[model samples]
Each structure stands twice: as C-alpha cells, then as structure tokens.
Target: MDYRESLSTGPEGSMQAHQVSHFFSAVDVARRGRWDDDALRQLAHLAIPEGLLGPRGNLVRADVTLAQARWYLEGLVDYAAFEQDESLRFGRLALQLWQALVAQNPQIPRDELHEVALKLATVAWSEVRARRIRHRARMTLDTRRTLWFRELDPRCYLCGYKFTAGARDRFLRRSRSPLTPPPLVDFTRPRTKERHLLIEIDHMQAVAEGGTNELDNLSLACGWCNIVKGRRGSIFDVDSRPIGMLDHPTLGWLSVPQPMWVLRIVSMRGRCEHPSGCSANLANSELLVAPYSSRGALNPANTLVFCGEHDPWKDERLISRTLVV
Candidate 1:
C-alpha cells in the first residue's frame, strides 16, 4: 500500500522520462554541456554546500549558490538546443522539473518561474517541428485567439514614404516598389500622347498648415525644386518683397525675404538701434517700412521668410514673429 509504487510509471515512460529529467536538471542545476548520465554523475562531484542542500532530492536554491547559477545558465543553453532541435522528449521532462521546482517553495517568485516554463513549452513546440511531428500551432491564423494583432502600417503623410512592420515580415511579404515621386521632366509645350513631360506631386500647401492627406492637396514638384525648397518655406531673390511668400511650380519660382541695412546697426547690447519704429524686428533684417502689423497677421500674404540679418531690409511689418523681443 505504498503511495510511491502507485505513482511509479514502473518501466517504459520511466526510463525516457528519467533520461530527459536528468538532462534538464544537469543543465539547470549543473550548468553543464548536454546531458549524459555519465556526465551528470561527474557534475554531481562538484559538491553542494551542506547548509544549502535540501532533502527533496538534491536541488539547490538558485538565489544563493554558484551551483544553482551554473545550473540556470546550463539549463538555458539546453532549453535553447531543445528548442532548435525540435525535440519534445526532453522538453516534456523539462516542464515537469519546472513545475516541481515551483511547488517546492511558495516564496520563490512565480512569474519568473512561469517565464522559464514558457521557454520550455515553446522549445517543445520547436522540437516537434524539427522531428517532423504534427502540432496544433503550425497552421496560420487558425482562430481568433491565434490571430496576431499589429498596428496599421505607418506611412509618411507628406512624401508618402513607407516603412516595414518588422525585419522578418519584410522578407516574407516584401511589398512592391512604392509609388514613385512625381516626375521632374519638363517636355516642351505642344503635348503628344507619348511625349509629355511628367511632373511629380508635392504638398501644395505645407503639410503642417492644417493640410489633409487627400490627393487634391498634392502638387507637382520637380527634383530641382524639391531639393531647393527642402523642408522650409521657399527662398526668394534678394530684391523681392517679403509679402510674396508664395512658390510657383509653373515657373519654378519662389519668393522669400531679404535682409535689411539696419542689421549693421545692432547696438552693443544686441537690441535694434532703431527701437522706436521697428520693434527691432526685420522683414529680412531691417526695421519695417510700416510697423503697424502684428505677428498674428503674418503669413504667405503678408509675412516674409527672411534671415535674421536680412530681415531689416523687408517691409518692417512683414518680419517674422520669431523675433518679437
């Protein structure tokens, strides 16, 4: 009536189970290379401290001993091998050992222990694959629980630049070449079906200025122009007025601000020399011709995009809002 005999597998499942358990324990507790009964017996020679030894059969607390640390490291290597080899015989045994380890001490953190169990379970699944054995998780998206969730693919709204979900997914589902940038070529006027110069589309209004992602918002930008425009508002000729901050695709023209002459008069303290009329603000760099306008009213229609030094030459009212000191 011994309870031990009732739980014993007696012969068949016992030897294979013993072989797998020995392998897992040797790696987990011993930190040794692959399990062989002969190798394990040698590892056992590395004595466990008498104080740290427990009676439940020879396991040591990983928290305190070098032996336990070695075992954990070796166990990970062994788990990784089993995972790669797709061998479940060793994995099932490993899982039993993990469960037993958790049950032995309630003080042991369960979440960390569960992480080890998951590694073993996943390793077993891989081993099943290696052995050419059939398994339930092999099929793709078999059910709702099985379906993997991911964010909708990201896209650059302004330039329509696209990126991949991840490195592996990129390989499996390599997407087609993205829509090319609008054509930059300019063919002479009389258009023929086969001979028209193509123009690439760009954001007509700046993307940041309350622009929508719709096609109507896009316009053609030549390679030359796009490079010049860069990310900033377009530049204007030195002679142009600050009020015309518009860029024309038809003529490849852009209007920007020009610096003022009074920039040379920056007082020793960095304040504008002519503080009364200009507010020290420059259209390009100079005081405004008319200082009545506030920065809130500045824009494509009135405000000019001028460098700090060049702003003074512009209509004083047309200077940047950035310099309102």
Candidate 2:
C-alpha cells in the first residue's frame, strides 16, 4: 500500500518517513514468499530510534507515522501463519514498533508496551473481545454503578465496609445515643484510612493506557482508594500515607464534628436528604427530598434527609415540606 499520504511535518518527519518506506518494502518481501532476514533486520532497525526524545523527554501521544507503522505491523502479523516463523518475525516487529514509540516518549510506561506486545504476539485479538471492550468504555456512569453493585455487592472491595441499604443508618445510630448530644464527625480531619462504606467504581487498569471497561478490569473501590489509585497501574503502588486535615471556614481544621455516615450520604447525593426520616428505624428509603435541586439550581441549604417514599405534596402538587432536624 502507498502509505506516503500518512506523513506529517515534524523534526522526526523525515526519519519516520524512511521507517515507513522500509516497513512497506518488508511487507512486499513477505508477500513474495521470500525469507529475507536481512530485510527483516532492516525492518527491526527502523523500529529503533536514536536520541529522538520528545519535548521535556516526556512520553507524548504517538505521532501519525508511528501509529501507521504499528497498524501495518499488526496487519503483517495477522496475515502470516501463527505456527510459522514469519508470524513470529512480524509479531516481534510489531513489538519493536511499540518499543520505538515508547523510547521516543519516556512518559509511556514500559509495562503498558509489554502488555500490548504480549497480546499481539499471541494473536489474542478478536472481534468479540474488541466489542466487549468498546461496550464497557461506552457504559454510562449509572450503569457502571449498577453493574458494580450487583457483581461485588455494596461493600467496598478495599476496606471491606458493607455500604448496603440502611448501613448508614446503623452506623449513625451506633455512633451516638438518643439521650446524649448528637455525635459529630470531623469532615475537616484528614481521612487516615479508606472509608469502606463510601463505594466508587475504580478502573483497575486506567482507561488512559487503553484499559478496557470489562468487568475483569473493573473493581469496587472506596472513595479514598480510588483517589489514591489515580492512573497508577495498581493500588499497591500507593503508599498508605495519612492525609493532613484541610482547613475550612465553616469546618475548622480539627474542631468540626462531621459524622462519617452523613458525609457519605452527602457525597452520594449532594445536599439531598433521605425522605425515610433521619430516625434509625425510618431511614430505610433511598428516596431524597423532592426537586433534589432547587430553582433548576443546586442549593446546599435545601438538601435534607428523607425516606424513599415519593413526596406527593412536593412531587405532584409542587408544595415542598420543610423538615426540621
């Protein structure tokens, strides 16, 4: 194929063009049933670059030429017989293309390349797998939440806190007594450990590095773990270090007593109260206060806890009931 049209202007343009030319030449050689190691070696040589570092020596996105080279290498491998040495040769060439891409962009982790190369070498690519991967990528946030909850249950995978229905109510009741003053959790305090009951859908493999949305690649993580795992290969890489308390105007550095369960509720549904009543026994409803947001806008003060039952007054008649906590 005439791949010259894929060329673009850059400091590496000329060198990349030469590499593409050599790659196509090798494709022609392979098509003619000629076993030429010298030509293949030249192809491999094209895969290696010399001191062509990207800006700030950081791994940037692969250029058009590199993308084209990778595509062609994958095609060549697919066309070759898996059991034949030619197939292995093309696979190695494809692997080298990724290496060259990474070499130029140091920010791209080598493990990512290794993972991709292994898949290519094994001819593990399939239409079904691709479709599944794409589907996962396209899944809505709500759908992901449903799927994660159904598959893993409501407890967090990391901290093992069961964040099931009514779990928050139980936690709230246990933290304080009816005769005593309501206990307050300090929201400003730095969370030293994972809040097990506040669950989040975490991408075990980050989507940035081509991680699929498949269930196997997804995990139920607590809010703390998800934030700490940001873009890293695994959660283990993150140090279990304590975060310092953040100072806030309403919530002082260490004096504010914000309940953990209340914070979890707020995080899940901002400023919205559960309609089932804040009382322990009546706290079984998932329904929040009607017109969750006020005046087509978010008003933090409007948020109140309510039971799951629909509020006929507010929902149907548009009359809101104020709950005095």
Candidate 3:
C-alpha cells in the first residue's frame, strides 16, 4: 500500500499561465511508467464505472480484497496527478466536495449538478477571500497619487503583470497607454480591488504589522501579486523584485564591476526588456545591450533602470535565468 507524492503544473495562465497540453498526458505518463505492474494493469479490463474515481466510488469497490482495492485506489491517485476529469489532482484534493453537496440534495440530477457546484464554489470562495478582501475594499488610493501613477502606468511591483487599460481613444481622442489608473473604487467592487488586471494599493509595510497608509509606505502591484504578497510584514519577502534591480533581496553577491557595462545597461533603457505582448521586440539582447560580454544572457525581467544615483557595483542586480539544455 505504498503511496508517493508528485508535483502538479498547469498551463502558463495557471500561474500566469503559458501553453500546456491536455491534462490526460499525466495518465499517459503514469500508466506508461506502470506498464509492468500486474494487478494495476488488470483493472483497465475491469471497466470501472463512468467516473472510476467519482464520489462514493469506495462503495463499488467494497467487495474487492485488500490488495485489489489498494492498487485500484493507487492507480486512481496516479492518474489524478495529471488532472483526471472528476478526480482529485493528488492526495484527494477537494476531498468530499461533491459528497457534501449530495448530503443535502441526494437526488440532484447529473446535468444540474455542476451548475449547483459552481454556485457553491463561487460563494464559498468569496467567503474564503472575504476577510482579506474586506480590508482593502474599504479604502481607495488618493486620486492625486493615482493620477500621477496613471501617467506612469507602473507594472505590478511584484510579478510585473500589466494592469487593465483605461478608456482612451485614438486620433481625435488620446490613445490608451500601457497603464492608466483605474477610476476610484472600493470594497463594493472587489474585482477592482483584487483582480490582477487592476493596480492594488499594497502596504509596503503590512497593516497587520502596524504599517500605515502614509504615501511612502504604499506601493503598486497587480491584484495577483498583492494577493500572494498577502499579510506578510514586509513586501520584500516575495519571489519577484518588484521595486527593480538595485534592491533585489538575496542576490547581493551579484555585481557588474565594469563601470562601462553599468552605463550601457542604463543607456539601453528598455532595449533588453521584453515588452508584454510584442514578441518581435524580444530578440537576442546581447546584440542590443552587450555583444562582447558573455557572462550569461540578459533577461528583460532583470533589466535595470536609472531612477537616480546609485553605486553600480554594489547596487547592480541580476535575475537568474535557466538556459534550456
């Protein structure tokens, strides 16, 4: 009855998901790996019901001996790792979700079941995020500050995802910029407060940590970044360096000793930066930023910008990139 764990991944949009294929590949891999396991292989001939892994399935397998039942459930777990339809991803995640619903409405038809589930899932999630969302919903950034930031269209301080654009037309009207501050909103509009597309006014210091609403203590982030940053005492603990390179948390050993290289990075401005949607703009940055230096390829995410004076050697930053082998 040995059970093991596995990591799970989804499409790019899953996190900030990129392309991923059909989930069935997980079953393909697991079944392929288990091709030689005798008892497990025999169950494919058992023609387990429509949902071999659905709720109440334990009832159907009650007659099978301990070994048969063990491998049967184990195989379900393996296939679930790749996101089997109607099965938990791993470790029976969302345990008894459907069971709880059926407890109240035993005869609910199959067609209407998912519709009811959606309502429960939707409302339950609002309740799940309710407390955290409540705090920010009560407040909105000052319009004066928003207007200033609107002009800049700042990227999320954490993940650097873009916020939704504001209404601005072309020609006779002004064009929409990469960023435009959202109209004043509050708790009544939770999406505006928490949706990743809009800017979130996160405390540089968390309110739970006794941080305040003072201007300097606030920073911009997409809703996704703000949510992950959560109620942490300081904003610096997260993975991404939202404040830009000079302040990368654990990369202090990083340095560009040559002043000429430092000046060139600042001069390139955004030449190394891969713009949000423009693939054409992203090419060999080495040709653009530095053709001679080969320490490694530059990533736009780690590109430095000149806000003011700082020591190039001490203040310089580097983002690690995994070169595909």
Give candidate 1's TM-score: 0.16
- All candidates' TM-scores? 0.16, 0.26, 0.24
**Which parts of model 1 are misplaced by more than 4 Å?**
1-77, 90-325
Q: Largest TM-score belongs to which candidate? A: 2
lDDT of 2 by residue, 1-325 (tens): 3344334443542346555455677667655645777655555555433222322111212333545654655553443343233224445555654676566657878888777666654443332223233333555656555655465345444333345443333333333322211133223212333242345667656665457777777766545545545554321233322233334333233222122322223334432233443442121222333223333211222233343244322332221111101
Q: Please rank every candidate by lDDT, starting with the best.
A: 2, 3, 1
Kindly list the per-residue Cα lDDT of model 1 for residues 84-197, writing each as its tens digit: 554446556457656765876568898788777676555444433433422222222222112122214322222222223342232223433332322221111111211111
Which is the better candidate, 2 or 3, if ranked by lDDT? Answer: 2
Q: Give per-residue CA lDDT, model 3, range 1-325, as digits (tens).
A: 1111111333221221111122344445547667566634554544332232232233324423444633533332232332324332322322333445556567887547556555544433332332232344234435325533444545444433334444222111244344432443211111232243545567766654445566666666545446655753221233222222232244332232222222223323433332332222112111123212224322222333322122132232223221100
Q: List where candidate 3 sits over 4 angstroms from the true fold.
A: 1-151, 167-194, 233-325
Which candidate order results from sorting by TM-score in descending order?
2, 3, 1
lDDT of 1 at 223: 29
Q: What TM-score does structure 3 among the candidates reach?
A: 0.24
lDDT of each: 0.34, 0.40, 0.36
